[model samples]
Target: MRAFDPFGWLEKYFSANTLHLLIRAVAVVVILAFLIHRISLYSRYLFKPLWAAETLIFVIFLISYIIRINPADRSRGVREILIPLAGAMLPFALIFSPSQNLITGQTNYAYIVFIWMTVSTALTVWGLWTLRRSFSITVEARELVTGGPYRFIRHPVYLGEMLSAAAVTIFRFSPVNVLILFLFVAIQLFRSKMEEEKLGHVLPGYIDFAAKAFWFWPGPPKHQR
Candidate 1:
């Protein structure tokens, strides 16, 4: 009789597809749990401006990532995965950082903070809305999205995230905070490059789509023009 090996049994029982499905299910559960926590935390400030926008972005994220087409090409390398993960976690640094008051001329910071956060959050929400089912953190290609802000720029989500990071950095201004913000933006841009490469490889039209708009700035998509 052959000796039983637990690892062999696990491998035999868990096919790659099954393992992937299980991992994704676990990820969804964790994300939903976090979303619930965030909602509970923010519920107290429901009357506050941009209240729904705060959670809406994350909800859209969960939806897009969960209910999406399988990737034609995906980066499963540890570096690729960690890059986006690091970028995502960088903004959380602001949660513990101390904020400083800034008095610019006669304007109070409340208006500035409100306007800045609102605009940035709106941009993020708009991008997420456009992405709907295609947006993801990892570098992968699903369906191409060319509507909404994608018509304006290649990566509105990253721009919005950077803007949000900037606002938070400003709120808690410090040398270390600024460094973290810059690092976050750099990672985002790097991830965009990887995404562009992967998309262009998997989707033939991505080249033309990229040409339609600048990587960071606004321009018309080819179909629109």
Candidate 2:
């Protein structure tokens, strides 16, 4: 009787492509589970006027990650689509490729990456929890939430998201990923400015809040007349 060869079976079935697909599948499942968990937790607050916008934002964030994990082909030649898509997807592709060389021997590097991911995740969760029902996708003043993370930064959520995104990019360590991170930062800054504009216009105390809170860092308060 022949002995069972588990290693051979695994090597045969779990090729590079198969492993990449498996990773992508696991990522999708995890993301969906997280989203469902958050939705369930916030179910009571879903009836707010800005619920649609908040839901849209969540959907967009999820979709962006899904696309990043399993990106489309770049041969389609759409420059606008390819740039961001390539930036997000190429890192994973390289990481999973059989010919690629990863720094597996560096234990400290791995530890740092783990720490970065943990901190980023905590920041993002803190921002979300602090926002609670006040969270809105658009720049509408659902409420001027000044407690928790908002006390230090006017846009703590953006800061958290950007930090998480940066950590992911750093883990991958690619120029394209850096470009994507920069682009994301620019978008978040613009969004923050727009939100401030709307809040300042609608909420009477927003000016005071802005004057007291930094945009996304711990610094001197904004100058107000």
Candidate 3:
């Protein structure tokens, strides 16, 4: 009946209006498409990378919203959107789950979530923007992304997106939300394997980059040193 708003849940932790839902939505779609392009050769998974389960879930959410919002279909609905809503909300909405009052009751935690959301969103925007010209969503991915945040981090945007979602989970403090994040992490790891194969075959510098860069997460392990 109500839309899930993660930023609203974290309003206590940081000032309101830090996260822009509309822009963030656009960013998600763009990034998903970009990542999907890397694994386009797979062909069976709707050109979806193995790690794009979150994007798939969001796409389903978009479809559900379309069904709910269409005035003509509203009356002839096959099923209420409750189940899909719960699945979608479980990832980020749990921060305000049970009730928003319970979360706002702890202003400090709320503030922390808000701040994390704000910082993560800012990094996402900046990182994505830095690669704007180099960004692509077609089958042909970038040759290399060493210019911007990519120089320091192979997956800065992914990290930022994960952080933003994590902030939402912290605000909600739901076990189910943590589970979804874990699922996402697993998907990203799988996608990394597929991407490395693609890059090694097509892109020139990828192997060297992989040698230096951490796959999904950042930072080299002690053993690497």
Candidate 4:
């Protein structure tokens, strides 16, 4: 008995390489469009000392994601390569793994994944809009923002990203992706600490804000009583 292949129809008309390239091109176009929209929304207020860091981080994220989604680079050996290159790239890797194809035939699973993606996207957008002009890619205190989602967690943007990474990993169910997610969590925690330190140094009210709000969750920091 021949095994059933849901995506076999795609291969009948398009070569695997061509299909992969098409998928990647679509991904790139979508990402670029979103980034262009975001930059336009924030363009007027983006002129700051820290905008360079923001731009660099965005570029690094885009490049890393594009690399990770390449079909040619999805080999087991490439995982070894990615581990070393997985500093800022780990989050993108977790959120967008090349091994996970976009050809799921299970409607229930697709619906669940869609719901998760929707929630994560909403959270990310809310976090971005809340931060507004104060959004910096690196740990810098332009203004002490403690409203909207920040009222609960100091790093709502990271929290949103974490939710997104979790959703993607859950949808794909890969051990390597779980490991990448853990690494992303560690990086975000370290970044959050650095941000808090910078804000505490620059803003006199940050210490009090830290006492009231959690770093990345609902509760206060572990060191707090």
Clashing residue pairs in all predictions, respectively, total 0, 0, 7, 0
TM-score of each: 0.82, 0.54, 0.50, 0.55
Off by over 4 Å in 3: 1-102, 133-140, 216-225
lDDT of each: 0.73, 0.54, 0.49, 0.57
- Residue 49 of model 3: what lDDT? 30
Query: Candidate 2 on 1-225: residue-level lDDT in tens?
Result: 113333235657677446545644675676577667656655554233233334444554555444432221111122222333443343234333221124335667655655665565566556766665554343335566788877877877777667767766766667666776788777667657656755666555777877788765332223422
By lDDT, the better pick of 1 and 3 is: 1
Q: Write the per-residue lDDT of candidate 1 for residues 32-77, one digit (tens) a residue.
A: 8878987887756523556677788768867865775555654466
lDDT of 3 by residue, 1-225 (tens): 224344445656765333334433565675457556644634543213322443433343333322221121111111123232333334444444453555568777656556666677666655555555343221123445665666666666666767777766665656777787776555444444444454455555666666676445433223332
What TM-score should be assigned to candidate 2? 0.54
Candidate 3: TM-score? 0.50
Best by TM-score: 1
Where does model 2 exceed 4 Å of error?
1-104, 216-225
Q: What 10-residue stretch in candidate 3 is worst by lDDT? A: 70-79
Q: Residue-wise lDDT of candidate 4 within 77-148, one digit each (tens)?
A: 222223223544676666455435542566676566656665665666566666654553434455667888
So what's the TM-score on candidate 1?
A: 0.82
